[model samples]
Target chain A: MRLLYQILWKDHSRVHLLGAFLGTLAGFVLLLAGIQFYMDLKAVLSENRDLLDPEYIVINKKVNIGNTLGLTGGGFSEEEIAEIKAQPFADQVAAFNSNKFPVQAYTEGEQVPNFITDLFFEAIPDEFIDVKSEDWKWDPEKGTIPVIIPQDYLNLYNFGFAPSQGLPQIPKGVLSMINFKLRLQGQGRGNYDDYNGRIVGFSNRVSSILVPLDFLEWANEKYGYFEKNDPSQIILVSKDPTDPSIIRFLEERNYDTIREKLKSSRMNIILKFVLSFLVLVAAIIIGLAFLVFLLSLQLMISRSSEKIRRLNKLGFHYREISRPYILLLFLLMAGITGLSLLLTSILAGQLHQTAEAWSLDISSSLHGVIYGTALGLILLITASNVAAILISTKKLCK
Target chain B: MLEQDTSGSEVWEAESLLLEQGKPYVVEAPSGRGKTSLLSVIYGIRTDYQGLVYLDDRDLSSFSSKEWSKIRKNKLSFIFQGLELFDELTAMENIQLKNRITAYHSDERIMEMARLLGIDPFLQRKAGILSFGQQQRVAIIRALCQPFNFLLADECFSHMDRENSLTAYKLIREECEAREAGLILTSLNETGLPNIDHSLKL
Candidate 1:
């Protein structure tokens, strides 16, 4: 009845109801926005992964005092290589093969400055190298050794060393045209051979100077005299570079890698920690707001206790008398649901705009899970508040 | 059977008593004679008395709150001595609160009864601002707006003067006769009313 509602609704404290409404709304918006941002960031993190080939990580033992003193070998043994191959993150593993003999390279043409430098060579299977070249092969009869050096080496020389040394920076094509001779030294002074060497490509994946695997094997067989040592470095390909276990496993085994390669994996761990903490805080606020909602409604009902009993005496059932309170609860719940979703979507839009300046692709709309979570939580709060309302109202009636 | 533990009483001390339909019964007693308690018991609001009250062969104690609500709506009505009117509601709204549920009386008939009880000018005023006699008249009109086999009036006319009491009582009798319902009117002293076929001292 209109009069029934007018009578019962008059006793409600406007401050209490408004406080409950705003409190619940604030809690819901925080929770929903946290979820939306988390999903978007996760998507963006994985999206960048799709732009590149699978990650190749080069790992070596940490250099400590024992390794410096030559007391311990700073390389992977047969058992250690096998253990690394068995790891879940290792999709493919290859050990670096080094030259067992001494080597030296010198420029012979006037187009480049005459220089001779001692060098060491390391080689892995061709598939792990990022650079592709037809000249990356060994031919004993042709007597030409093709070499691949790190791109960072050239960059360091061009950017750091050339300007300080008053030398011109040579481009890659000019470097390729220069002719050089490599002298391989065996056990005796006369037991050596010289071969022509050429720079074929620069590698971004591996940091050391590289030669074709077959040429290194052949040269080691012919000129090797020093004691054989374990491989000093191993390169592994991982399809999921964002897997945090890659970093954890490396740390546990005292292995080191260029940390820039696993930046995404570290970011993923940190993002998960921060988002979970955000969700936990949201859950606590929501829980406390729910209590305020329950108490506010209960207080309203108890304030109307006399009118409810009077209505009951006039032939109104307890359920009938509880109509006003139930309607109020429903209205507030619906408002919270609608407003929270709107606020979360606005937040998502803001994040999308900010991420755009960084050239990151982020979704501006809310995910389906956001809607589902909002509805589920609102239903939960509304149902419990409704039960409390009915119970308190029934207590006041005959 | 109806029973209670009051000495020097006719209805309470009696082994059994039956109040029939289409009859007006006056319960006469001084203050503190359990007049309101007797009406409340019959109305299913009080169950503490040591007695068995029956309506149409059904025990009063057996009725659930839902059933009691239904009974109150269609089979029983009470004009409580406290009036039970919403103080914030206008007199007309208080009457319509009950009338709207039953839809038993039209607006014209309600206005006519208010005019007869001399509360017509105050119908639009809040019940809390009206005098006790005016609030009592509103409660009388409210009780008469429902369909009931029994009308329980617990000293409802105590606030009104003799003439207003007689006029309200006549209206009650007319409504009861029209529905063929019974009336159990309790009073603190001798009311000296007319057309009351039975009087019980409690």
Candidate 2:
């Protein structure tokens, strides 16, 4: 209405403009920041998938002062394994089997000169091994043994050990081609055996050299020196790693976990928790900002209450009296949202450059869905508040 | 007609005083005799009184605030004793504000009313800075800017001289006649209105 326009134009004040602009800007920032945090957290979680399996985790007994001084050893007892298996989250648990005899390995080939070194081997259940290479299976009757090595071991050799020793770094394809010869010595207590050892595959899940369970048992039996011993490390398959109870149980027992696979997953879990907490805080701030806007509206209306009363006495309906206020607030929110989106877009450009530098796969852009959600939520909350304030003002017209 | 009390006892009364459209009535009273209270009751601004007031045989007390607003918008206009105009607005703005409510008057008609009221020269002056008599003329013109079936004036001419009061009353009477509206006025002395069809004393 022309009357509504005249009233608004005549009553414009700096106080009103400042109050509305600041409240709207604060609310816009909170919403945009919260949404950006959530998106970034989602990207981090997705990137962690290549680092760790969600269902598989490796743990060992915590190393204490007694363990270092040889007063105790860092190994899992039978009762401890039984207790772990009884846990509700634990779907399956297996221990790493270590050879109990002295062993040495060497390679003699054209590309790889003869080099001899002491070696240790470990074995786990075939079902727990993620690498599906057919050659990984070993039989005592076979002439050669198949082994799986950690992928990072080659990296350490190529970057750290080989360079220091002035030797050529062994590429994965060439390493798999050469057969490693192993000699088991029993020191006159039992007969020694010589076997050909070949690398079958590399596993990201396990960080040690892996042999077949059958092979480790046969070799330990043939070169028996002492009684069988308990395992020092364990691999557990859980239904859900993100369950808080699982972490609590591990911490309560003072167990140490392999950080390689769990490093990124653990970070993801923590980041998700932080994301939720930040969103709740942002919601509270937004709620306060909305109250500020409503209070500003109340102050403006109170300043003009006398004119409003007179208008009402002249038989102008309540809607006519409140139209200008609702219109002004709607316009303010629209403007603030537009400015926030512009700023977010600019910030997203910078985020893309940072992501590229970090070698992250995340695309730095504001998703339309998130923008649409933020706009819808802001307008919905503000409109409801405006309607409530107007209704209360109308009630006071008497 | 209805009579009621501001204190414990009735101050004035009349028997079956009927106000019809296109008629004029004058109520005479001494000072502090509830003349303004009587006009306020008729205008639906005062309800804390005893006695029944009716319009078309419907009890006035039964009307809701919303219904009273409708009556004020389409059927009734009032000029209070204080000439209750927005003090911050100019004289012309005061008239234009009322016209905006009903849109019943054109610019030429408003100008003609201002000329008749002798307030055309002061139309641009703020009401609060002007003399009480000038504001009273402005309020009178504002009252006529809306469509009405009745016009109630509660000693609206107290600050004006007799000449200006007569001129303001002439414009009011002409506007009321053109719209077939009844005029109910109270005065401490004679209003000098012609053809007084009804009379009351309080």
Candidate 3:
């Protein structure tokens, strides 16, 4: 213990302390921040699962030169659908049913009458539809059709179309209160009818306008003049949205998917990659910092080599002389680890505040993964240095 | 047994040596005759030799490092020729260091010994700052601070004057007599001490 006091009171390598503190702090921050980003991203994605279901994906054919020049059909064929169904990743597949008849939609009961515009109506199986409001269903007996539109459409209307047309911007709740009229016509069959269409909800998942399958079937049966038409868009229920195989498969087939959900999935992959890369970099920097620590210790030991030899001549054992060095290293390592954890907590709290400003809920607690990794690094580094000091002191004793 | 130099040249040879308990032996040799090397071998500090050494019945070569440390701490004590003191420590600390381990003498006893050796005035001074004779007396005092069955002195009095040398020898002889320990003193020539029970010239 007296030896320990002497070693601690005398040994001060400022360069080593500065190097270790700054290097390890930087490495630890990068490691913790990367881990924090990954955790927050996962949390946000999980919370928004209703908006972007990992089990569902929007698939379309590649719009290439062959497709534009009419060399190949720009849609899924029966064989193509069968091929998709055979894949292990595709748990279920559903096609968007299109109304073969022409559609004319216009808003009614509004202060400023909206212009009548031609529109396309698509439908999917009720089981595949995410919206669960009572108004989302169709009753052909009542001549009322339920429709779901993209949320982006409302944003465009309120922010772009309404101002340009000198119409008051309408909020979503008020817009849902207003009724609309839809006109269906079969050109060659000379059949026409008007029905009441009501907006049930907005969809962030599916961008295209949606109506009930029952209404689409009845309308097409009564007014559609063409033969059964192939669907251009298909909804695929992938087993795992985060699977690299799914992305690779889509890329290999020269197919495209929904931009928003695909972006989310791609961001997840990129975050994982960045996390691993940052951890690797941190590991390398930590190794260097530990090396600097060891070099400093070696310098101190070599400086005291003469004293050690003298003490050995006086019948001092190696363990007794080297204990002080090992203790100092252990205390230093523990201090750095503790400071890093504190800094991480403070930084994580600031990140949480930033996320809250963006209307995202994120936790500021240290993630178990980051904690475990830091602890492992501290233990590994300290143990290695202790062993090295012991060995060197033994040589000195000899 | 022959003690060889770094070039493997024989420097000193002894056919037989026996040290009886409670007896003093003076080993005399000229300079560069491995006088210090002989003391080092007996103290278990050097093993690079061409012959076997035995402490009683056990061969010195078979002793592990721990065993050697035990012998140094409990049984054998040596005052090196160069007086390998910790320069960073004080003269008082140098004595206290060994005394702390051996606990053979109290602080008052150590101070009394320091006073008799003429080192009590520089007790708090760093060993590096003291004169050669002062440091030699400090080393002598440190060596005597420990309990031992054998005390090896390698020219410990070379830097001291005759009067101081006699005083150191008197104190060492009295301590050895009290402990029933054997004293091995290496010197360039005999001093004709009547108390010496044996003498070996290498």
Using Cα atoms, each model's DockQ against the true complex is 0.73, 0.37, 0.38
Flag clash pairs in model 1. Answer: none
lDDT of 3 by residue, A29-78 (tens): 77777787788878786675653455678788878898789887878888
lDDT of 1 at A68: 95
Report the Cα lDDT for residue A231, model 2.
Answer: 85
TM-score of each: 0.85, 0.80, 0.79
Which candidate do you rate higher for lDDT, 1 or 2?
1
Highest-lDDT candidate:
1
Top candidate on DockQ is 1
TM-score of 3: 0.79
Predictions: Cα RMSD each: 3.8, 4.7, 5.2
Q: lDDT for every model? A: 0.91, 0.77, 0.80
Tens digits of per-residue lDDT, candidate 1, A59-102, equal 99999999999999999999999999999989999999999999
What TM value does model 2 have?
0.80
What ranges in model 3 sit over 4 Å off? A3-21, A41-47, A50-55, A64-69, A77-125, A133-204, A207-231, A237-252, A269-281, A349-365, B1-16
Residue A236, model 3: lDDT of 81
Kept native contacts, as fractions per model, are 0.90, 0.38, 0.34
